[model samples]
Target: MRGLSVTETCFAIPGDIDSPTGGYGYDRRLLTMLPSFGVNVRHLELPGTYPAPSQGDLAATVDTLNSAPPNSTLLIDGLAYGAMPSSVIEKINRRIIALVHHPLALETGLSERRRAELEASERAALALADKVVVTSPATQRILEADYGVAKDRVTVALPGTDPALRATGTGTPLQLLCVGTVTPRKAYDVLIEALLPLKHLDWRVNIAGALDRDRETVAALNAQIAAAKLEDRVSLPGVVVPATLDRFYESTDLFVMPSRFEGYGMALAEAMARGLPIICSTGGAAAETVPDGAALKVPPGDVAALTKALESALTDKRLRVRLADASWEHGRSLPTWNETARRVAAAILDIPT
Candidate 1:
């Protein structure tokens, strides 16, 4: 093996570069910022069907890793790394850093056999890495407690929030926004159930995310909305472009994310960054992301609590303002993208800053 190169690192990511999700956003932001910190990041595009890779995909991944220059530092995105076998790990001679957005097994809708397999595979994969980087402290704790990863081996690099215009809600009918992919993990069903009883309230909701990810859930949700006669009050606009999403944030009065789990609640942070008040589930990293008293939180999958919180936020104008104010203050306190990149670079380069 050759001696290590201190100024360059390779990042391996699966799926499309344009995927509009938080984990993808994190990788994109980091790749954009790492070069400024004097580390040349080479992005290695892995096959899309990770965590369920075909034999061909696995062979391609093995070829990619085996072909990397010896002693080079490789940062593998968890989606690809978590499913990799130890035989593959043994073939790579370079230092490896695993970037875990969240564990694979925590994803919703997995069968017991699949979950156990993922848990075991991920544990083995993480064990093979030289360092592990998690996006939030909540995720870090989960690894240490549940996955048997040592606390010292893990580093937390919280996702960054860009500065944006604060929302100026249309006063007549309050605008509530939910930004996340429509999947079982997001618990849009719970959100829909919560919104069902609030039809009399002068408010409208827009769920902006990739509905194509789960067609069955999307169809069921559509049916639920139709059956409840909420066609006018609720809308699912599918994947939103940046300009349109900004407009939604700019005009929104409140943001809600009823996710059952998150490695880091990037959408929630974005909303807070834009000074939108929040009502989110206390699932995974959410409670840690939003400051205390800044937003209301309920146990995940608790429809009644979510409904009650929504009701309070809608009915009381002062409560909304107070939450928004606190949220804005907390949002201002989050680290910027460059800072996050710098932290990761420091971890990658073994530099203290």
Candidate 2:
């Protein structure tokens, strides 16, 4: 950490970096900025079937890990690393650091058996790493307290937010936006139910995320929207481009995320960066991300509480403005990509190689 010495490192991540999710976004941005801090980061695209890798995927991952340059550190995305067998993890020759967004066992809608299996595998996999880098303090605690990682071996490198044009209020029909995948973890069903009571209110919601990832959830959401007679007001524009996403942030009156859990709520951070009032559940790192009084937060899975918050956000213009102002003020204080890269680079440098 004394000098900005260049350190070569290989970062293995799942699927595409372009995937419209917080985890992928964090990886892509970190890779893009690490070079500025004298870290030579290499990208290794692991198989898509991660966190439950098939035998073939496991074999491919082993081959990839075996090919890393000697003395270079291996920084594996936790989605892949947490599911890898302990034998594979233990055999890695170089220093290995896990970049865990959150534990996979905490994902909603998993069977108890699958959850237990994930918990055990992740605990084993994490134990094999030389060090662990988590995105939030919440996840750091989870690893140390629950996964048996030593306190001294864990580091926190929070996700950074890009600056954005302050969101302008959309008059008449309030424009609501929720950014995240259409998965059970996001709790879209609760958001829909929360909105169900406010159909008479003038609001148009745009849920932008990868709808293809979870077809069953998409189908269920569509049916729920249809059943609630809100198809016209609610639209799911799947996996929007960056420019389009920027437009959504710029034009939105309120940004909402009803996630059941998050390691660090990047979407919530992005929303704050854009100066939009928020209504999100305090599931995981969400409360840590948004400052108090900047947004209306409720406990996860509480449809009634969400409904009440939505009613206040939609009907009370003064409250909305106040929330927006607080959000803008807080957003101005968020860390930039440079800072994020610096902290990550420092952590990487601190890792014994």
Candidate 3:
């Protein structure tokens, strides 16, 4: 496919675009950045009840999509796109471009019936897209292998990272930071268990992200912290503002993400952007997202392994410095938002009318 081109496309995203989650952040940035690269994008805000929309919301999704300019290409966010009825998907007049952050079936904690349903629905939805854009290579592979999408039909556009200042630790209690919504998939329970054994070490853990997304996970994590008597050492400062989050990145000594799966670890990339040493699990695209020297990789959901890595990172100065050095060097070369938009625009332009 050729590079960036001048083309009009419609991006239909479910829910509030201002949501503070990684997937929404990706979409927000693309909406802001794609236009500068010659891809004229018109935003369509679908009903927020997606991934499990009611019958009425499903009909609204179809109607909203069908209302787009007939000549414009329709780019649908996978959150809603994948769940659309195949019959309704075929009714839209515009050429379809599917942007999949990750397959919905890969999400943690789904029942067998729901998982099977999502798998079947997504497989059907993706087939109608003129082109598919995935946030990571791992996701691209998953679609091709499991969803039966052809290799040539998909494009891998890694998330873009903004430049950040290097972090300088607050040495008295080395600052540990984890960024992600408090969801079951994020595996905060595993993180809480892992950090339990390391309380004696000089570290204060701050989990920064929205807590309201999953009330059960939040309650469970709080219970774990209370039971472990880590209430003083660990804190969940939900949805830190941009200024405070920047301060967190600036002062953090180490970054950790123990997600059960990641389409692409945007938080990890943000950590690396700030030259912070990382400890993350090898789930989905997480392992490949951070280079070996840049992080202490552990198997996902392995509380013991995560605990060991945490202890080592906390106790050893040399390891943190070495990893940070690798991270700093790599961060300088990460793709910019423009590049991300360019790749997507190329995919959009590649679609045959």
Candidate 4:
């Protein structure tokens, strides 16, 4: 990390770097792993009010990026980068690299006008970057077709999955799990609805994520669960520790992601790492992230479809076994953290002298 040959790269991130979310996890991994590949990373913490930052916050964000070493590369997280004013973007002097976890406009619950505004802002910011790094090919295509980014200007770096022992599920009561922030984008309410008619079955649900990110969504989901009389059947444990999350995966009978969309399904990959059977939506890049052999695919937002997939997985142990076997194989083949870092370092080194 102290070597003179390493590229000086600063990561411009908004919000808690330790927050239990996939995008932050990716950034954190790069900060630690990039140095292993001869790239020295400096963390630039920006205001947490991103995708809707105030004017003052925008000024601070620009100041932070501009403060990086004169020869350093400014690697901005898309959460803040995509929403910055074009005028603000024109001020940064460092070599720029944008890490687009996904387009801001794709988040669920944004109004049409808001979506359009975000799309415009992101497109503009992406246009100015020296390089753009994406998590998946599906997102690369999205940028190519919709964001107007040149195909050659972007780098595809898949998120890594840690190796894990195959799960030994508890059959006494089938455990269904979903790991992600409890935002509208995750479609937790929709998952609740899909689980309603299946109350008579022997099963439990754990939707573990940060509930603080969207209080209204959490409150609405809680009310929905109570009204459906699933208070005892479903649990919202908020954010669990890494060890606890691993235990949840180890004991899970089926992994479910009813997300409306995903830039890349990191949780899906984690579940696969544990060789757990999956039932995920074909939302955003999800359909392409999880192989058909490992999951029962359903269109995002279709409660009926999700319910059908859930029912089949619950009753058919043989089906789960086949899916889990495929999952184990696929999980073993998923990328590692060092590889992810190598690609990010390569993207950083590619910046002009």
Candidate 5:
């Protein structure tokens, strides 16, 4: 079979891709792994915000598409579609696949005008694409119900976990880790509030991510931590390198992602891969990401429920063991990048291009 070639419209492979905007992280690991399956992947970086595509931007995209080998596949990741010209979409020589991380309009707490703009842009993108790829069944349903995307046109491709996150140690203080940008959508404030109720427990939280987007929310979270006297108990260590992140995973006893919404919690998958027990909210795609018994699920924005779950994880050794075992099972079953590449190749084969 001929190898498949794919290009993405944002955060290309082997790049320094970090965002302070609570956006997802795409790393070099994917670039290194995908090629093993005979798939050639290229990432194209685009501007951050949207107001429809400018002529110059559209021209650049057209040039990129024209330069691609005939029969190659192009995948536009989320907002990239909104920022590309309709003429470019209509004239592309290769098959077009769009990956919707989430409906950009539904991003938590955007103003009405901005939300409407995003919705308009997303609708245009969906209409222009030949096929759409989503990570979870929940997202598929959303696309069908909200965006009016036909079920047949949307493919569900689950994201893979990095194997480098395996567990290495068991130690004291029961290190709990939360990873992601500090933002309102992540509900870091709720996590902080929940920790207040568990002050008597011997657990420490290490929140690692850049402070971005939600400045007000981040400020409130810091204030809450200070007011609750959790400065020593909870540390906001900011962004760390991949090796340091691995060290955190090795030392971590549990992972908590109290997000109000997530398209697919990549960090949750990474933590589970490391055999860290999980506690996440049942919002967006989280229910699909976390397997039963592998992670505790709670209603979004519920501080009391989060507190109770954290306390249980800290005090009950049996629960921890159960979670660890379940996490191992869940992690082991996840598709590797080779598998992901195979799936992408299969999808490309089905495309008429």
Candidate 6:
């Protein structure tokens, strides 16, 4: 796959690229790592805005596809496909494949109109693709149920954590880490509310991720924290370097993500790899990723439920031990990036050479 021309269409790469918006962080890593499995990848950056790929942009994309070499395999990441035009997707080369993290329409906190548009775009892309790779069984179910894609067209290739994230050494003041963009979908506010209930516990919550998309939601969460007098117990450290994040994971006692929805919960997997106990909402693919008994699970947006789970993880020594053991065992089963790339390559090649 390293030398094969693997064209990727994605919403954005890193900020260093032509894309105006920064990425979800995984795209850049995948772009660099996929080549190790023999994929000679070319990234095509799409616009940041929703209802993406205007008429002119669609025409340009079609022209590019039409001119590409015969048998060139186009890899369309699901995020970019959801924003693109149906007509544009229809013109995609027959050798194209799709890697679906999740359906954009199911993402939390989108306008109904936008959701409809995204769903339509996804339907078109699914129809055009020769194969589709999903990250979880839950997403595969959605693809079949909602998009009406044939079961044979879809394959599950779970995302893997970076090998660099592992337990380093113990530190004082148990740190509870949550990493993801600050947004309504992430349910940072719900975490804050849960934290308020556990103020008596001697622990700190540090959330590090991009914050531009949810300034208002973040501000409201700050106000809630202040009102609850949890200023000293919680910190929004914003985005941190990989080294810094690994350090946090090493020292952190627990990882919590109370997101209303998640496609694959990559951060949770990273935490598990680091041997950190987890507390996550059983929404979307989270339930599948965070196996039963491995992590405390709560209903999405249920403040009381999250609060209780947080309290248990913070105070119960036996529960923590159980969680740690389960998490470590589960983490060990995760596939490596090379494995993921190989699976993707096999899907692309489809038939014996």
Estimate the Cα RMSD of every predicted model relative to the unseen true structure.
1.4, 2.7, 2.7, 2.9, 4.2, 3.9
User: For each candidate, what is the lDDT?
Assistant: 0.89, 0.88, 0.90, 0.91, 0.73, 0.74
Ranking by lDDT: 4, 3, 1, 2, 6, 5
Q: What's the number of clashes in each of the models? A: 0, 0, 0, 0, 1, 5
The prediction achieving the highest lDDT against the true structure is: 4
Residue pairs of candidate 1 with colliding backbone atoms? none
- Tell me the TM-score of model 2: 0.96
Which should have the higher lDDT, number 1 or number 5? Answer: 1
The local lDDT score (0 to 100) that residue 334 gets in candidate 3 is 89
TM-score of each: 0.97, 0.96, 0.96, 0.97, 0.84, 0.88
In model 3, what are the clashing residue pairs, if there are any? none
TM-score-best of 4 and 5: 4
- In Å, residue 298's CA in model 5 sits off its true spot by 0.3
In model 2, state the lDDT of residue 318.
95
Q: Write the per-residue lDDT of candidate 6 for residues 1-353, one digit (tens) a residue.
A: 22444443322221234221123445555677666766666666544443355676656656655555544677766666656665676665446677787788887877899789789878877887778888788989989999989988877777766564456434346678998888888898899878776777789889888767668888888898899888888888887877787778888888898989888888888877877788999889998888887899999999999999988888887787788778887888887766666676667656321
lDDT (10s digit) by residue, model 3, range 167-263? 8867778999999999999998999899887777888889999999889889989998999999998889999999999999988999999999999
TM-score (C-alpha, index-matched) for candidate 3: 0.96
Q: Model 3: residues >4 Å from true position, as ranges?
A: 1-7, 351-353
Q: Write the per-residue lDDT of candidate 2 for residues 266-309, one digit (tens) a residue.
A: 98889988788999999988988998778999999999999999
How should the candidates be ordered by TM-score, best one leading? 1, 4, 3, 2, 6, 5
| Number of the candidate with higher lDDT, 3 or 4 | 4
State residue 311's C-alpha deviation in candidate 1, in Å: 0.5
